[model samples]
Target: MRVVILFGSEMGTAETVADSVADALSAHDVSVYDMSDFAVDDLDVHDFHVIVCSTYGDGDLPTGAEPFFDELDACAPDLSGLRFAVFGLGDSIYGDTFNRGGEIAAEKLVARGAIQVGEHARHDASTEIRPKEMARDWAATLPVPALTSA
Candidate 1:
């Protein structure tokens, strides 16, 4: 399957995890892109998407993700044929919004008619386990083709 791994990071943990996820899925045709640089207008619904993003100050999306988010919101494309999954990096100590960035991004995608292929994965920065390792494991079990009939 062809997939796109996009990352939005502040301190780089999310970017590192995105790389780990991409590497783990090497069996598939995978392309990596920074959310800030990805051409959302050129996004193809035929490819699966894996979004790895970090929650920045006060549960907001990292700086790198803001432009993509704005472009998506403005364009509001009907992503009914798009397949996606989200992995969020956050510190649980931050309270209820621990992984709010990922949640928000996923919600927006779904709102635009994208088919979420798997459960959203939440990685805790406060944990002893490395985020990259966690992402590796998470990506391994993703039901990537669940929405093939969509």
Candidate 2:
């Protein structure tokens, strides 16, 4: 199935992670786009999606992602046939808000009727973990056929 990797970041960490995910799914038809350049209407039900996003201040969506989410919220498109997975970057030091950006994205997508497949992966800045590798592994485990045949 075709896969699209979208990223949202301020300092580009999420973009880097998204690149790794693309590499991991290189065998498949894959495309990567920055959230700032992608529109909500671009979502295709036939394709699988991976969202790589980093939480900004107070666990809010990064600057690059706000516009896309705003548009999605405004359009409120029915994404019932869309399938996706999420990988979030955050600092656990923030306790309650850790990885909230991904959480918010997932929530919005689900609210629009999108089906999320596989695990919701999160990378904590407080650890020495490598987000790119983590994201790549996470992408590899996504159920590509989950909604493609629906």
Q: Highest lDDT, which number?
A: 2
**What lDDT does candidate 1 reach at residue 115?**
82
The 10 consecutive residues of candidate 2 with the worst lDDT sum are: 141-150
- Candidate 1: tens digits of C-alpha lDDT, residues 66-121: 99999999998888888899999999999998999999889989999998877789
Q: What value does the lDDT take at residue 88 in candidate 2? A: 92
Give each model's clash number: 0, 0
The collision pairs in model 1 are none
Per-candidate local distance difference test: 0.88, 0.91
Question: Stretches of candidate 2 above 4 Å error?
Answer: 146-150
Q: Lowest-scoring 10 consecutive residues by lDDT in candidate 1?
A: 141-150
What lDDT tens digits, residue by residue, belong to model 2 across residues 1-150? 689999999899999999999898887788999999999989999999999999999999999899999999999999999999999999999999999999999999999999888999999999987898788788878887733454
TM-scores, all models, native as reference: 0.94, 0.95
